[model samples]
Each structure stands twice: as structure tokens, then as C-alpha cells.
Target chain A: MALTLMKGSEAIAEAAIRAGCRYFFGYPITPQTEIPEYMSERMPEIGGCFLQAESEVGAINMVYGAAGTGERVLTSSSSPGVSLKQEGISYIAGAKLPCVIMNVMRGGPGLGSIQAGQADYFQATKGGGHGDYHLVVFAPASVQEAIDIMSVAFDTADKYQCPVMIVADGMICQMMEPVELPEMKEYKVDLEKKPWAANGHGFSKKSGRSIINSMYINTEDLTVHNQNLQAIYREIEANEVRFEAYNMENAEIIVTAFGTVARIAKSAIDDLKEEGINVGLFRPITLWPFPYKELHDAAVAPGVKAVLDVELNAGQMLEDVKLAVNGDTKVDLLSRLGSQMPTPEEIKEKLLSMREVL
Target chain B: MKEVIVLIGNYGSGKTELALNFAFRAARQGKKVELLDLDMVNTYFRLTDRANLVKSHEIRLVSPNFVHSSVETLSLPAEVASAFALDWDTVIFDVGGDPAGATALGRYKEDFDALPEGSLTVLNVVNTRRPMAGTPAKLVRLMRDMGRPSRQAVSGFINNTNLARLARPEDLRYGYEVIREASIASGVPVLYTTGRPDLLETFLSEGHDPAFIGEPMAIETFMHRDWETFTKEGL
Candidate 1:
């Protein structure tokens, strides 16, 4: 495929389409509105369905209904909007329906600034909704990574019958870049393949009347269901911990970050390398699986001094870094909350200051 | 003599960035510049979002009234309607996206029509990387179609093809070729081959400087991926 210049949202929408997404239900939100806008333009041409839900709550439930049909369904929104969808997301997770959610995060405790943010790390990774469940969250740093991860995200959601969240910051959506869009998947939306689908009760005679609900009336049965969900999460954690270790060869410190911050820090790490500070970066690709072992190994390598967790939020991912480092090394945080972002020079300064402390 | 230039282009074609640069450059030259952001359709990453950046310079940004309100309602203010009657040396309308967005310009038809012939120029910004407007034919089609709803004939073309931070000197030459072909096809002059200062310097250093309309305007990118690099003050 030839590279074409496209905005991040458009690229991701196109990626979902190529990945066999035939239904896109979303609401208009800052940063991520273009995702639904693009889908609205393309979905009809490809015989797909694009519906702009009245609200994020309505959108996620629509995704829930669509996913239950065993079709690749996508719903995207920003911070506040994603928060609105949490209940539906929890319900979808509980029901074990496969679907993909893309959150182009913005700063917030409420309706925060329309700027890029990674504050949703905890909400996405630790399960924002009330349930003993974990969402497989992929945090991509660049527009290309975000686009590339969409197809895999849908597949991963389908494979585990779980909801996978592609949580990129607003920059990844607002930025323009040349992307090689994926080839369209040769996928037939076969309800028979999904024997468990409530697609008109498997589109024919079905298994036990095909009821899709999270309500397990019996307490013991619910316990077994919760256990099964936990087992799936464990399986995910074991097989799907994805992260990148940059310049860790004889690194005195690890500037661990995720998503857009990781990219900015990578530039800072390169600059720091030229300035004689043996610093590196540990960027987690999967926020939920957390890359604990790999991160711990990188942090505990010989001559490694300390670890610095940086983020767009006020150190939400810092907790995860602490858990990963697990006292194997000293851990600190450098962050700017809300809509503010630290430049690469600022990141370099923070790393240099950390070096001085070590 | 006050000059009013409206910029029209496809989505993601660097119209707002060019408008900001043109406004700032003219203001820096001591011109009383008034910028009318006719792009309410795009709520974020538009001129209204960069109110602080515009304030940092000499330019007066005529933002919509409801831009900063609790309601994200998009409505035209008196200032937008009275943009032409105002006393400003240079007025740049960062018009909305494509032909669809050009309808915003249609509302100011009388204001644009009353302007002296020599004082008005609607320049179509063509980013060749966007395949929808990549070729000479497509560029011409955009020039003709975008002019209809905009109520102004596109007098020129601004070749803004770029990979942003990844842009190089050759990319300029590539865009120049496509845009130059479109310019020839439509008899629309190539006003400026705009690029970031760094990329322009690289192009000059490589000794590929060619004769076109003046020196290519070196734009200060106000949005897109490197937004953090420029929006620090705005935030």
C-alpha cells in the first residue's frame, strides 16, 4: 500500500474498516470526533453502518449490541466521553462481547481541556468500571503505531471475547502523518462462525435461546464466571505484555513513559545520549498487561541507577512504574497535569536532574 | 489599500497554519492585520483554539462570540459580518474546509463582492500528499468547485505539500511540480510555495532555489503533531 498523508483519526478509522469493522457507533468529542466523521463518510461506501449516537452512553451500548452480533464494531471518544461509556464498557466486558474502543485521551477530572493527555492509564488499565475485569489496553505513541494497532486490537478483542482499548493521546489524533493503510481483511461476517452470537439467535436455530446478559442470578455461577474472566485476564497478562526498551545498554536511569510522552522522551533520551548521560526509555505498548517483568529487568540491569516515570497526567502511570520496578530501583515521577505538555528539552532537563540526584 | 485574502482548501491542507503565518508576517511588517477565523465547523485545532497565540503577535483575531462560552454552539458574531468594514491593512479569512466549508464564506458574499477587484484574492492551498487533490486535474477541480460556495474565484494556488516535521527539500520540489502543473492548467498563479523555515533553509542550502512568486513564506506551524512545540504559550 502506498503511503498517503492523513490525520490520525482518519487513519485509525480507515484501519478499522480494513480490519473488517462494519459498524462504527460514536459521539462527537474533541480530538476524536474526526474518527466518527471519517467513518460516516466511508462506512456507507463500503456497505458498513455508521451511526452517530446521541451520547457516549448511547454509543457504547450500541457497540455492545453490535458486538453481540459477532461483527467487528468500533466506538471512539475522548476523556469525558469515554468516562460516560465506562458503565456500558463494564457491561460489555461482563457479557464477554468482543469489541474495540478507541480513546483519544484528553486531560480531565471532568470535562478537561481539549489537549493531548495520557491520564486515562489507570481508568483503562485498572478497570474504570465496577467489576473484577481487565481491559486489554494498547497505548500507541505515534499515529502510525495507533493505525497499525487497530487491526490487531480488533483481533485481540475477538480472540479473548473481551473489549480492547486503543488509548492514544489527542496528539496522535490531531497530528497529520503519512500512513500505509492496511489491506482490507478478507473477512466474511459469518454468524455461523460465531456460534455463540446472539445474531438473531445465530441467524437460525440457536444454543439455549442465545441470551446475552451480564446478570448471573446465582451467586455461585457468577463466581465461576468471574473466575473465568480472571483466568482470561491472566492468560492475557502472560502472553500480551508489550513494551519497547530504548538505549538500555548500560543505562544509569530509565525514563519510563507511555504513548506520546514516550515518543517525546525518546527524543530527549537521544539528546541526553549526546550529552554523556547514559539514560534510556522504557515505553509500555500495552498499558494493562503493564510489561512488569521486562520493565523490572530493564530497571535492574547492571549499572542501572534509577527509574523516572513521566506522563501527561499527574503521575497516574507512576504507580504502575512503582509496581513494575518493585523496589528493585528508586522510582520518581516528572509530570505536568491537565492540558500542559513538557517539551523534549524539559524532559531532557528532568532526566539530567535525575542523574544529578543519582 | 486594505487587502482581504481568503484561504480555502481540503481538510488537513494547512490553511489555518498558512493563515496564522500570513497574518503574523503582515503584522510584523507593521500592517494592521485582522484575522477572521471562518472555521467554526472544526471546533478544535482551528483559529479559535489559538486565540492566545494570535494575541502574542500584533494581529487581531476576530473569533466567534460563542467560542469561549459554556455551550460549544457555533454562531457568527457581528465582528465576522463587519470584518470588511473594519479598518485593517490586511484581512485574512482562514475559510472552512473544502467546498462544504466554503458555505461559511457565502454568507459574507456582499462584503467580499463590495471589495475592490485588486484588493481581494482567494488562494486555494493544495497539499499534494492528499490524493483527493493530488494531481493537476484534481487541483483544478478543487479550485473550480471550492470557489462556487465560497463566492470568490480562486485567484491563485499555494503549494503547501509537506510531511510536517519529516519534510525535506525534495518534498518542496515535488509539491512545486504538482502545484505548478495545476497552476498552468487553470491559469492560476502560484503565489507561494509555503514551508517551515527549517525546510525552506534546507531547500536553499541544497541550491534548488527557483524563481516563483517572491520567497516561499516560512510558516510557523500552529497545529498538528508538533502542536506541543508551538502551543506551549497558547496553553
Candidate 2:
């Protein structure tokens, strides 16, 4: 219960430690390297294992190894590094491993820049790695949200026995902010209860079988497995649609955004609200099973004219907004691509321009 | 015409190591080689610091201004494009990890495509530990998902585990087999095997350096060889 000024990436790393994450693996990359660097410096003090792997690939595999042991494990990387991490992420999902993966996105089609951008939204929520599986993804807009959602990310991963991703971008990772640490609680990880984990040689001998965390199985078995996965996904959809609304009452417009962009939108909303434009914000905390119903309601809300979806990419989130809004509300996009982050003033200007079009 | 072979791979799979060694080998052969470091993905492992040594050997060192910058294409200011348009014997573009980081290649695909038969070569580093580091099945699936089919690309894989700890030349050898197997299974060629230049020197001097030899082998041929035979015979 202490307040500290920290970068979003540093806060996430500290929160992971407090949340009982004792194993960390990561490769250093810009904007998000602080997470790994911080873990490398401090993980040893808590008798934790921190391995800065040969590359993002090795780091992710190390995570896979730790997760297999039912230990609290985490990995962090930026856009390019995250791209390298996709393969491991997919395998973790197929195996239904419990772990935390963080992507501090930067601008780019190729090593875009060290600057912030939201280009990886589609990649993160849609499953960056290959497969029919989803990682419970949390999009944090501030340092505090980074800590809070990361705490929830661990719980959700354990609850679902799936990998959870904390998708932040360069801005959130690099910017320093005031974070009031949450009340400390002893971290309790119950990997022993899960019959699936590879705890040690003794567990395997006692069980009289080697546990395999693979999706590949006989045709009938594979089908059953997939169906079960579907059930889990449905449960998540029903139970995990989380979002925050600001100034929705009597608002004529809903500014739909997430992560760092959403925070910027909130400031712009305040400015526009004072100007009597009645603009509100819908920031989705869980972007994976995107708060579709929340989006639908915002679009159909009384006096809502249009939903202005702003982002750091060239309209990646626009399509989702359109789908969720379902043509009832006019969907407009304000975007920038490749390392360019749109500011609050620019976003407000776009919102006003969208009103004119409406 | 001067040819440029760009080495592309995920981080820590040894792009910098391969590119550096390849540049030296090509230079020794009297080929006017220019090794360009477009590796903007990693903050370290840049070859720009050694550019003077490379230049002293009469080998051209063409790169963007920010050699230390991660994300080659985006950080290597636009001026580097003119360098690409030039006539060089070998131009190696050490791309960053992931296809998104290869965005610079988006424009040059056509240019490289126009190269006289067997001009452009893309060497992909494969490490068994990373995300796509799984079996060949996973690599194919990932390539397909990323929309970069290996069928047409002159893609070959070199297995290299650049891990500082628990990494020996043996780890590199294991990497070679995994990557070779995946390349063969995916219908890409096992163009070469990579290791630290010192370890690979004997093969390099014997003209057996698989890294520089232009081969037209496809993924099918790569996969056709028996796993045991290839491992023993050096795939």
C-alpha cells in the first residue's frame, strides 16, 4: 500500500512479483526491455528464476518450461519481439498452459520504431500465434491499470488454464506515472491441484503416467478437446467482458478505444465534455473476447450519434467497432500507422470532424 | 551483377553471426560483397561498429545511419534504398525478427524477384526454442498464417541457438538438424548450416560452406532425405 512513480513496464514487473510470479523469462527489446531488465535485477532477491534467454524464442520456451512445472511464469517483449514470441504463445495455448505474456507494441510493418503504437491489437486479441485458441488479453491504459490487470491476468490464466496477455504499447511502457500500489497479499499458486503439470519426477511416478499437454490427439479425441475448448471460450465470453465507461450519461458520442489510446481519449473526453459536446468513452479492459455487448450498448445508447474509434494503427480496431456497432451507429476511424501515436488534441479534432459528417 | 543475400531470422537465431561470416567468406572469394545490416529488431549485435574492418578488406559496408537502431527497415532512414538499388556482388540484409519487421522487403520483393535466376537468397535462422521453434508442422502453419509461403521464396534455414548459457557448438548442431528437418518438411531448402565462424572455418575454406553455395533445392528435396541420414551426413 505504497505510492510510487514508475514506468508502466516497471510497474507490471513489480506487480508480477507481488502476485507470486517467481519465474521470469524474456529477451530484451526497446520500450519493453525495462520489464525484463527489472525482473533480472530483482527476481533473484525473492529466490525467483529470471533468465534473459538467447532470444525471444528461448525466453518464451523457458516460460513454457516453467509453466509446465506449474510455476508462476511471465515473459515480456515489444512488437518485433512479440512477433518472435507468437510461436511459443500458440504452443502455450494448445497446451493450455498458465502463464503471462506481455507485448509493449511499437509502430511498424517491420521493426517500426521504439515509439508507441497500437498496431498489434488484431494480432494480440485474434491470436498472434496460430490456432483456434484465445489468450485472455488485458489492455491496460495506465500504470495502475497495468498493475491491476496484470494481477487479474494471472488469476484469469489460472482460472482458465490458459495463457493470458497484457497488451500495452510503447507509450504506456515508456511513460512514467503515479501508481498507488494495491494492498499486498501473499501470493498463493496451486499448481499441485492441477493434475496436468509436470512438477517433478515423483509426481509422474505417483501418477503412473507421463502427462502430455498437447492438442494433437486421435480424431475423436481432438474433436472432443476442441469442443471443450469452445465451451471454455464461451464461458469466458459470458463472464469476462470487462470495460469502463466515462461520461456516457446524456452523451451524444462514444469514443471507443483501449490501452494507452483510451487514456488519451479520456482526457479529450473531459475537454470535449466541458465544451458541451457530450462525448463519452468506452475502454475495454478485456480486448480478446472484445466487449461486444458493451460496444453494442454504447452504439445504441440514447442520443448517441456515432462511435469514433481511435487507434495508433491505420484502422485495425475500426473493423471491430463496425462489427460491434452493426451499422446502427455510424462508425468512424481516426488512426495513424508505424510509430506515430495520435494525441488527445488530434483525437478530439477528429471527433468533432466526425460529428460534422454525421 | 553484384548479388546481395539477406539473412533473415528470429532474434538470437544468429543473423548477425551468419551475416558477418558470410560477408567474410564472400570477400575472400574476390567477390565484391557488401553486407548491409538492416537488423532493426535488436538493439545490440549490430555490425556497424566493425564497419571499418570490413571496409579495410575492400568489402563494402552499406547500412543505414543508425546501425545500433533496432527495427532495420523503419529505423534505417530512406537513404538506404538507394544503396540497395546499386550494383553489388552480395548485399546481405540482416532482417529483424518476425515478418512485420521485414516490411522493408515489401517494396523490394519485386526488385529481388527480377534478379537474374538465383540472385536473391533469404537465409532464415531457426532456433528450436522460440515460438515457431516447434516441429516442421508448426513452421509451415506459421508461414501460411503469416501469408509468407515458402514455396516461391528462396528460403533456406540455418539452425543456431545463440544462447549465452547452456549453448555450445553442439546446441548449434542440434539447431541445424531441427531447422534442416523443418526446411525439408516445408519444401524449403536446407541452404546451409551456421555456427560461430571459427568453428565453421574448416568447411568455409574447403568451399564446403553451405552458407554461400547457391542451391536450387526446394522444401520437398529437403524433406525427402532421411532424418538419420541427413543428421549423419550433415543436411
Candidate 3:
């Protein structure tokens, strides 16, 4: 179809539908409620299932069940509601279920205001739940980027048999933009390819029964399982570390940011360029893979005086920037809590002041 | 021009944008104007967010507890009921998106019904990209649905189809074709079609038929965007 203007949440939902995600289980939570609301209307018309469960916890568990059957599944919620899905996410991770969990993050630690915030950086990149596991997280900077990543998310989840998360904030979710969608991929059940799926075979003696469970009674067996999961994470880290580096040739300062904040920084950088300021930006598209090595190179690039980490939360991504820089250069942070947006003017002022770091 | 004009449409269909533009258009013509945010739903990105801009235009704006209320409550202020008693040259009702948002107007149905004939005009603003307004049949359905809640017949149609900065002349023509068919079927005239000045300049420069698209109305975007499209793709 030709380009059409749409709310980011609705576009992402249509992207999921195009990506062959036929099963959606979610609860209503502002900023992200449009995903499930659009699904509720379009799912049945397409012979798919869209179930609004009693709670966020219930919805995620439903994702686990649907995922076990090797069907592409998706669930979305805001920050507080996403917190309730942690336990279920852990179970899905342990059981190695392939599904997508989208969070249109809002300001929070507890019932915080409904506005965009990236405070969930640690919760998403680090293991938010118990045990040694990771959810491949994609942090899209724009609505079109979010729509483009949904297809990759499902394909990556199925490829590694792991759950994935697409984290966006209200700034991107509520904004309207034009998007050219991909062709719809038809959903066909071919359990033969996913032999590990819990789908029932013909009950023939030749087909072996598959047990979809994370509970390992024996400590030694669990240890081996954990090792295998670590190996998969390593492969993902090597392959999926995607980031965008802008104006890094002989830069004076490098700013590392993601999501909508990155674009604000870009607007600042664009204006600063007119005044002969030499600056660059490094935006991480995949949060879990983190782009550590690439960021470090950008940080240590010739003529770089310092690295500025900008975010909507109180330096949540600052920790990651420091880890990536590894003390190769000094890292300063520009942060605000509670979804208070820093305009291009504020960001430019901060950048000018940060130049004193030299 | 009617004294009281109600602008209704689906969410993101540019209803609030048109409301703000209309109120300013009348106020600039040396006419007293009152703009009412009669929407009870839609927490964020409401017309109340731009009260300062409206005040500068000399148009009195009424809404829920606002003037940058951080709480973003979803109830209309009591002053909305008193808007009818004001002696303004024009009163524009900026209804929330969808037919359900007009449910709040039921309390003022008697006041609306009692208005002198032709003093009120209810216009259905449409962006045909939205499924509810995608076709002629769907347009008729939405027009009736919006009319039911406000207890007013939709007297006209406004085509406001867009795709942000990417909107081109052809998209307007395509939407106008469908909206025109909708107008014919519903017995409502195509009052006008809206586009930004830049878009309109390019639309006429491209040699599109003006008669096919009706009167073109120029409007500016009013909502806040934390960031901008800093690249050629305007992502």
C-alpha cells in the first residue's frame, strides 16, 4: 500500500499483522492501548485471535501458551503494566518461547505520570527477572523504524527461540507519521519445521513427544541449560549490534542516545553545526545487543574531547555509555526524570556547557 | 458563517487542528469568538494544551482543569454549559475524536436543538486514510454516527486527508474523489478541503483541478512535537 499517516501504536500493530503475528494477548494501558484496541477490531476479521486478558500478568502468560504452539504472538503494555509481566517474561525466557513483548514506556517507578520516559533501560537490557537470561530488545527511534523492526523482531525471536521486546515511549507512540508498510506475510501453520514446538504430532509412534517446560529438577541439567542460553546470547551480541553513527569524522564531542531523545539531540546538533560546532551522534537501535564495541570506537575517535549521554530518565542509559566507553574518554550525562522533554534549545545549551569538560 | 460550528471526526483526522484554525480565522476578522473543548476523553494532545495560543488570538477557550494542568483530567469544566449564554460572534465546539466522544454533548442537546435555524452547522471532518472514513459507505456511516450523539444533522463535509509532511497533491485528489462520492450519497455538500500552506502551494503548482477538490482551506499544525524530522526521509 501507498504511504498513509498513522499513530505509531496502530502502525506497529499493522506491522505485526504483516509480519505473520496472528495471536495477540494484551491489556489496556494508555499510550500503548491502541495496539490491542486495533488488534481487537482487526484480528477476528482476519481469522486471528486478539484476547484482552484480565490483567497484564494474565496476558503475558497467554503469550507463553500461544508461543509454545509455535505461533507468532505479541503483547504490549505501558511501563507499570509491563512491570506486572516480569514474572511471565522470566518463565517465557526460561522455557525458550518465541514471542514479542512491546512496551510503550511511560514515566515510572510506581504509578508515575503517563508521559514518555526511558527509565526502563536497565530493566530491559539487564535481566529484569530471576536467572541468567536475556530478551533481545529493539529500541526504535521513529514510528517507521518501530514498524520496520517488528518483522525483524519475530524472525529473530523464532531464530533463537527467545522472547524479544520493542521498547518505545509516548513521544514516538502518540506521534503521527506516514509509513509505507511491507507486504503482508501469510500465516500458515507448518509445525514440521518447528519440530521443537509443543504442537501435537499425528500421534504416530515415529514422532517423538516434546516437553515445553523450564523446570529442571536436576541441578546439573539446569546448569547445562543455562550454558546453552549463554552461548545463544553471545551469538546474538556478535550479530545484532546495530547503531547509527553521525558526523563522527574528527568530532569534538560524541553524544550517545536512543529513541526520541536521539532525534532531539540531532536537531540540536544540526543547529550547532551552523555555528561551527563539531559534534557527532551514536544511536543504538538494538538495546540488548547494546553496540558496545561500536560505541567505544566512536567515543575514542580522533579529536573527541568527551562523550555526552542524553536520556529522558535520570541517566539510566548513562551506565551503559560508561561501560561502552570503558574509561577511554570522559562521559558526562544530560538527564531529566518524569518525562520532562528537553527541547533542542535546552540540549544545545547543555552541550555548550559540556564543552568545558575539556 | 454559522454562530456555533461543531467540528467532529475520528482521532488524528485533524479535527482539533481545524477547530483552532477556524476560531482564529473568525477572531482575526474582528469577530468575538469562543472555542470550547467539549471533549471528555483524550487525555493528551487536546486543544486545551494550546490555551495560550488561543488567548493571544482573543478567543476565549474553555476546557477541563487546564492551563497546563499536569493531571490531564478527562472531564469538561462547568463553564462549558455557560458558553451558550455568552454573546460571542462565533462559538466553535471542538469535539473529541469519534462518535463516542460526542456523548458528552448530550447534556447540551436542548440548547443546540433550540438554536435558530441555520445558526448552527455540524461538519464532519474526514481523513479518508482512517478505516472509518476509507470509503463512501464508511463516510456515510461515520457522518450519521457523529450526528446522532450531538443531536444535529451533519450539514456538510470537509476533506482533510494527509500523511504528515509526505502528503502530496495526489493523495488529496484521491481522498477528494471518495469524499465527493460520500457527499453525493449523504446529500451533504463538500464544504472545503484543508492542507498546510506549503502542501497547498505544491498542490496548485502541480496543476491539480481545483474544482475536483473544492475550496482549499489553509491550516497550521498546533500540537507539540518533542522532536522534529531532521533528515530527508522525515522519519
RMSD of each: 4.6, 18.5, 3.0
Q: TM-scores across all candidates?
A: 0.84, 0.61, 0.93
What's model 3's TM-score?
A: 0.93
lDDT of 1 by residue, B132-167 (tens): 666888788877888788778887788788866666
Two-chain DockQ for model 1 = 0.33
- Per-residue CA lDDT of model 2 for A141-248, tens digit only, reads 877788888778888888888999988876667554445666544664444556676775455434554364665668898788878888999999999888998899
- lDDT of model 1 at residue A231? 94
Number of clashing residue pairs in every model? Answer: 0, 23, 0
Give the poorly placed runs of model 1, Cα more than 4 Å off.
A190-193, A200-209, B20-34, B43-83, B86-90, B98-103, B131-159, B165-235
How much does candidate 2 score in TM-score?
0.61
**Lowest summed lDDT window (length 10), candidate 1 chain A:** A201-210
Q: Better model by lDDT, 1 or 2?
A: 1
Scanning candidate 1 chain B in windows of ten residues, the lowest lDDT window is: B226-235
Error of 2 at B213 (Å): 69
In model 2, which runs have C-alpha deviations exceeding 4 angstroms?
A183-192, A201-210, B1-235
Name the 10 consecutive residues with the lowest summed lDDT in model 2 chain A: A201-210
Candidate number with greatest TM-score: 3
